[model samples]
Target: MAVVCSKGDWFVSSCSSTLVSVNLKQTCEPFVFDCAKAEKRPKETEGNNKSSEGGSKEKDSDRILGFAVSSSGKHIALTDDHKRLVLFCTEPTWQCISTRWVVRRGTSLVFTQAEDEVFVADKSGDVYSFSVLEPQKPGELKLGHVSMLLAVALSPDDKYIITADRDEKIRVSFRQAPYNIQAFCLGHREFVSTLLVPTGHPDWLLSGSGDGTMKIWHYETGRRLQSVDVRQHGILQNSDADTEKRFAVSRIISSPDGRHIAVQCEQFPSVQIFLVNSGIESCLNHAETLALPQAPWDMTFDSQNQLWLLLESEDINVLLYRHSEQHWKLCDTETPELKRVTEALQAQANVYKGSVGLESQFKHLYKVTFDNMASYLQKKQERLEQQSKKRAANSSKHNVGGKKCKKESSPVAQSTS
Candidate 1:
């Protein structure tokens, strides 16, 4: 369980998959359990020699593919590779409060703003919503997509759920009463890779596609507002001399203010940010570039509006983009204290059966470190921008004086002649 958040607290699950939880309000110590070497020891209880449910937990029962926390940060909803939906309450401890098998092979999980429930999308092209607690059978919503559902997103108001599929279609559904299928956003000619709802705008939804286009649309009205074709920007020109340029939209994200949109494309060699609503617009507003060694899987913006990008490869690496500084900074994942904690938790996970002790610890540490680094870099970028403006002003003044000297010399030379 690798936990990621705005704050750098991370947890690694028994399966070595990490979930980093950012945006944690407080620091909490974690318990690490190493499943590889862990053994279950049962103690007789008062009820007819019964054992504690916690002690009798099963190891490797679930493998999480994607997970998300509620807006309140009290509830966590996760989707395992087996397409099971599991919700947990994080206040007391990491306990499985509820488990509802929503999809036969679930690929993604998205939570509403209220945190009362989550929407699970499956590989077989089925979507279902289940309550966070109490009620069992989930309300089923059968979706027909040409291919698998690739990405899912919830609106800011949580009134609508937007899903993108491999067939390059986006479906918007109302979350409440009617629970009606609102509209199908059709534009991309290839598989859709990601979907995003710009911060503070509940009405706007953005989609990125393998067709190399980043499209912004009005969720409620199903109107195509704007389309940004990345390949036309000339940033990903094929340098093979004879080979043609091939680019696919890897990820698309909008800034917190909704004033800028960022796009990450395959083989593009960098990330690009575009100024939205600005008259000076380009497909790729080459503000900054990140020469990533691998393809980026996902990107999220924290409260400070800094972008934390993750790569989903065997060797995972997270990078933070400093927009003001126009550079990409790699996250420091090698702190001695963090390393010690991680190692300890990993060892414990190997020793405990059915225990999520190590996963919780890894999640906490990941959240803390990622959040801290994002905040620090955001401030650093602001300072650097200020310094850059100051230098530019001073340079302009120097150039003006040189021009005045040239004018004064011109009059003297003319008079002498």
Candidate 2:
């Protein structure tokens, strides 16, 4: 629910409808923007989903469902549970630029490489594009799939729009002419949860799914280069049987240089690292796993290529990791920038309830397995028992018939003697 993302000098996250921003390169207090407290802009035309008259108050379900930060760190956009697409400008300072309505709830959002438009993917399997230059304009329908879209991304060159759905399919379509299909990356056995197009690798695309595996792909051709089963690393060990069954790849992020990849499961306490080796035949080598005391809700790489972790803890909510000597070392969270962000979040309105201990989003989404072998064996045993009973009855009938004939013959022999 509470996922964090960063680009350029800004690391922003959303708690329900309210967005929290922390300037990574500056020592300024964090800023919070609540959609409920802001004024709604007038709609240009009536939408299929009715808009409340006079900017009716936000509903209980109006939490920030999806959010994205521009590559330049100058803009941010978030969609709420209220079917609203809200945009913000952070360069001049955190300010609400526009609030518009969507026909359905948004699941994932991203900006194009040019940062001219923000693409929002909804649970209804539709992709809508909203223009940043025209803030008050409604989103135009792009392309759609038959299943609920779990993740959406744009290629580095902004030529392709990639989308993943519950049907375990990754589609690469022309961004402008979405009707023209390019390729399909089809290997996952379960619902896809996240998609990533690494920064330095223009042709490479990475994806994670409920199947507990991550795959490397060439976006244009849909060729799978390598597939890594994260379960092999034992990053999902737990005593709870149910929790283990629900494990899936929740997030996948990579460094700006495309040398390291961090893959995280839904509620696991550890993160898996994979080293991407490029050569004549490039492949992924499992690097290591970093265990934490608590499960992290999200992980992201800033422009500096360092990892920032958002944890579900009371004492501290964020941690920084620096790469040194081929290992990630925990940096002290006492830096002025981090301290200001933490303090500001703690001091802000009592809305810092981390998305922990809530009902998991993947509970019902996990594939259900049936014990077909067990049932098959039981039916075979029953059939054999019935056949044995029939054979025994036939044998007893034959034995009784022979005994009657023998008794009749003995009586005849006695009479003759």
Candidate 3:
């Protein structure tokens, strides 16, 4: 559910409901917020041992399936199974102030950068946008996809909206012109799990499907930029019949720099990093799997370019993967023995093809205990500074408004006196 940057200053929300904040600048407390307690309990606990794809939403009523954070880090949009769209202010605290039920069962929520509009999609494949600034007004647009909406994403420029669905279709539509459907990118043979539009590239869309392949498409040209068969790489293709999952590609993300694309391999417990070349080719081989302490179902990179993996199963371990001295290392809260097992496996050939010297970093096996309390405290201090800046901005605006109001009221008060 949460990924923090390397310096431990910034964080991002994952599949979890609450925001995880860290202050790396201080060493007293690095992480804050209890997302688990904030979530609504699952409907049923029967067969609690059941396993699902890494990113699958738990049966808990409070679990959030799809969410999008604004580029400016000022707002967050989230959706639940009840077709509710909840908007929260990111500064000061994670407060859910705006809530609206768009459909009987909503699937995804996205927002435009320049406008106050927030988009919500449901299982029916229909998309609706309500103004976050004014939720009571009628939604600006209503459009339909060819199939059930699996995921929804707003383009980098917030000009277009793209949706991937069960019918293996990706539909692109304008944000302002809701009645018009721009184009459909059709190629996937199975259900689509995720869709991503890189930060600076609005014309391109990256999609992952149950078909076990990640495809890059040029939305403007309706062309297939490239397609990499994720299943054919590493341990993915070797899945036994007894271990097969119902869906695939739980999550996909384009790195901040837009040079690489990392995709979660369904229930395979691994992540594949591909090189985003001119034609969307994979730079790493089958060994590019970034192995987690457990099967990683949800993941994201922080501002420091560190990998934060969230496990779906009973193993509540949140592992942090950092790059130092030219090799990837793991930072975890597991036992020394368990950490050793992870290091041994990660250092194996089947994990990453091009490298091998990264295991020495694990020899220290740092634990998240009081001894390392300084690391966490440092992170907390940084968050305090960010919060302070937000408060300052609000205070300045309030003071300016107060002065203007006083000036305007002077004439009225003089006449009354």
Candidate 4:
């Protein structure tokens, strides 16, 4: 998974037990830290030993759950499946500032608006907050839910802490005093996978879920303003229960200008775009749909609002699309640095293998054909329309000539009589 920082840097979570950093210019550097080797608190080792004993030498606990970079882009916090929280400083060098162990495995991580504190939501439905200013101290439990927390975020002003759980509920609580519940944005039929607050629109909240819908809400009042069903645009049909459950909306990203929203679903190659405006009844107007070569694993918009899509394929290429002339166009140019990063990730992926390699290659080839077919159909439609217009013009001329001949023949008949 690739996470775009506020400063336009990329943090890639690798399965090779490392985190890679790509700078603004797309230069790749390995920020190596082995959680297995990191020193843990005395009490934390017992749980680690037990988890390792029950699983293979490669425990899932070693994998990273989530990570986030601070607003200043100076610090980063990441959580692993082993309930280990590691904070790093990205300035002079990528150094691990501190390592704090949590009670349960974390599902999501986010830094506060001021970047002074970082919050981690765990599988046990509890939110823990650790002050970045103090690295040695343990994290304090903030708030929790009855169900597993899937996502969390803070309001731009840091007024409220919003959280979502597997039960399809989004809770808004006071940032300072989380016990005082503010509101619950409840409308999702399935687990809420992601939450985002638009840049300029602090009052509005955007959420994507397993229900195949993206909803816009007024976070303060907990009002459901609109819901857009994105399944119609993709191959996932709502009627199929298995398909609906499998193809949930994985990510929803808003443009920097807050005028457009981009949505991606799991295993879907198509990216849906929506327009945001006050008078709009539903944001599902389908402003534009971009067909990607591979299903996107992650996506983000840069400072210039150019959409970047990271494909989940063998090559793992990043595609950039820019809006031009009332349409979204893919730039054919590839930066050398970006190409190098893609090749590096691809090499890393090849180290792990299964029978799916051949199948994925075929899928990529099919996607190319699909794209060409779409272009061919579009041109074919235009040609057909032009031929229809020509036939209509010729028919109108024939009608005018027949009318003139009828009039002349009528005058001749009258004179003979």
Candidate 5:
């Protein structure tokens, strides 16, 4: 199930390459943008032809990779599997602002604090900056990493750009001068999946990883403030449960106020909330562990600071939680706005029910580890044997050739005698 996010009155979600944005205010109809139906722009088509033949494969399957809304909630941007970045304006009404091509498929999208530029991190370990004002302008390369970048986020001050990669590293770089490395938040045993610079806590950075841990850092200096073992917080898994997934943090989001942090594992039915006790020396204090009736496919906190959960079940597809008086209380499921949003997203109910993606999505991301020493020794032995066989064959060929040459010389000598 695609993650659900909200911007002001707009509650947006994506399925496949299609984006569905509904106005909870009920003034605007549920707006849908399907990349499949998008007509090729002459300029974009011409530019596509100019691209090197060594570009991303034409999967013909255009699916939304990730999307983000600006902090002001005035703009929303998304990248699709077809190497296209689409932006939408959410002012008076939802309208397509721009559709541009990225150098490669984007893994994450983030808007700078200025909201004038959108930064896209791709599988090639590079980040690109696209202009929000100049819709027709092409993207410019910002920075590069040695390994594939999984997530990218901007500092609240827009001075630093934080990036996470498949190489199990989080890099903090100067946005204006990317070459000037700020610090490296190291220690995640596995690839990091999400990065967030919490609201109000400008210097603090939170990251969730495949290692099933959440690490907080003083992003500028790269000093780790705290590392939380998320797996340990929840119930112990049975012997047969997958070790990596029982605790891997697939998603971590902070409330707009940055007072609460929500962590979830993919397809897991429980969400853990941690209270941020912010000060000069701040850390995460465990608040509550919520066990849901059905495994939530995705969830997000709205602009109003209310949590919205999209579950795997279709009958009760949505749940809302309001934090009142220091307690999270469940809201009525029969709200009018929720009904409209659900009706617009009814087509994706079956897709959400499909457990294949939910269960196996993060499973493939974890690097499969084996004994490299054993493998190396085995390969070395095979190479030595192959060399020995080649040497024997070469020696036999040389001997045969020598013998034949000697016999021909002997026949010539006998004829001369």
Candidate 6:
């Protein structure tokens, strides 16, 4: 698992069961604590034994399901497959601040807007909030869903809590009173995998789903403003009957200024960029489509809007892209720490599964195909618009001529009478 801090530092968990912090210069050092040696709650151990008695097995302790860094860059949190939640401090050397066990394995984690609290969503569809300042205290249940919760986010002002579940429902509820649901954004045909509200646009919500589409929603009114068919952009092929089940939108993130949105799939070498504007009709204009050398495992943007991509290849490298001359250009500088980590991971590649492989036999499609299809669709839309305008203009001219004839005939009839 990998997370990028606000200050452009990267906190990545390696196969060695250690979390390493990489600074801007690519220097990497072991984090203060080893996650393997962290103490497990007694209750969690009891639960594990009960599960074993019931013929169920416990998950690997080293598997990290979710990881996140607070927006302020002061706090970092991660949840492992053993149902353990760990928090750490980034400054004055990395230190494990707190470690607790949740009711179930967590799937996602997010910090509240104020940075005072952190929310953890488990596989059982329950959300719990804990005070960041007080690590010893227990967490309180905030909300829940009947289906498993996949993603969660907070409103900019902390007024509402937005959550997406496996049932293709995005629920908006009062932050203070989660039972009082404000609205539901429901249009995806399959499970919703990701949810995001742009940095500046508090009223709008962006969602991606297994249905191979990304939708823009007016969260307050539960109205779907726009739907972008991501499958058309080479994420999936139309000939595949199981398109809905095969491809899913893995991630969607907006730029810090909320001017650009980047989208990615589970196993793909390309990232789709969309330009956000005021008008809903054109909010998802395809600004640029970039193809990378390797399939990207994760991506994030820094304060300066530089796009950072972590590839899943054996050569560990973070590709940086900067907007220049109306296009995203790759920077020439490469980090030495990326190389170090890649080499380390490569040496131990046989000992452990290093977070980079596809389970299914999905053929790799080219980005040029998607670009060509987009261009064709744009031209087809333009042609249809032109034809409609011509027909409207001809109808107006015919109406004018008919009125002129009627006036002439009326004068003739009056003279004859």
Q: Which candidate is the best by lDDT?
A: 2
* Model 1 quality (TM-score): 0.62
Candidate RMSDs in order: 23.9, 8.5, 28.0, 19.2, 7.3, 18.9
Q: What's the lDDT for all of these models?
A: 0.58, 0.82, 0.60, 0.74, 0.81, 0.74
Ranking by lDDT: 2, 5, 4, 6, 3, 1
Write candidate 5's Cα lDDT for 81-198 as tens digits.
7778888888776788888887677899999889999999998899999999897799998899988899999999899999999989999999999989999999999989899888
What would the C-alpha RMSD of candidate 2 be, to one decimal place?
A: 8.5
Query: Who is ahead in TM-score, 1 or 3?
Result: 3
Q: On residues 208-319, what C-alpha lDDT tens digit does candidate 3 reach at each position?
A: 8877677878885668877877766655455553344333666777666665567876445677766556533543233356755455646776665666665544433456
Maximum-TM-score candidate: 2
Error of 4 at 405 (Å): 99
Please write out the lDDT profile of model 1 over residues 51-112, one tens digit for every residue: 32233333333445667666555677666543345566666566557555542556567777
Task: Candidate 1: list runs displaced more than 4 Å.
Answer: 1-62, 133-139, 142-147, 177-179, 232-235, 238-247, 255-260, 266-269, 278-286, 311-316, 325-417
Taking all chains together, the TM-score of candidate 2 against the true structure is 0.83
lDDT of 4 by residue, 1-417 (tens): 444333445434444244555564555565556565765556557566456456435344465667887766788888876667899888876789998887777888889988889999987799999999999788899999998898999999999999998888999999999999999999988788889987778999999887778898989999998888787775553343355234577788888788888888866778998877767666435788887777776777766777767676555566777888878888664655446545555555542222122322112111111578888999999999999999999999999999988987897778988
lDDT of 6: 0.74
Steric clash pairs (candidate 4)? none
Q: After superposition, which runs of candidate 3 have C-alpha atoms over 4 Å from their true positions?
A: 1-63, 135-141, 236-247, 279-287, 324-327, 332-417
Look at candidate 5 and give me any clashing residue pairs: none
Candidate 4 backbone overlaps, count: 0
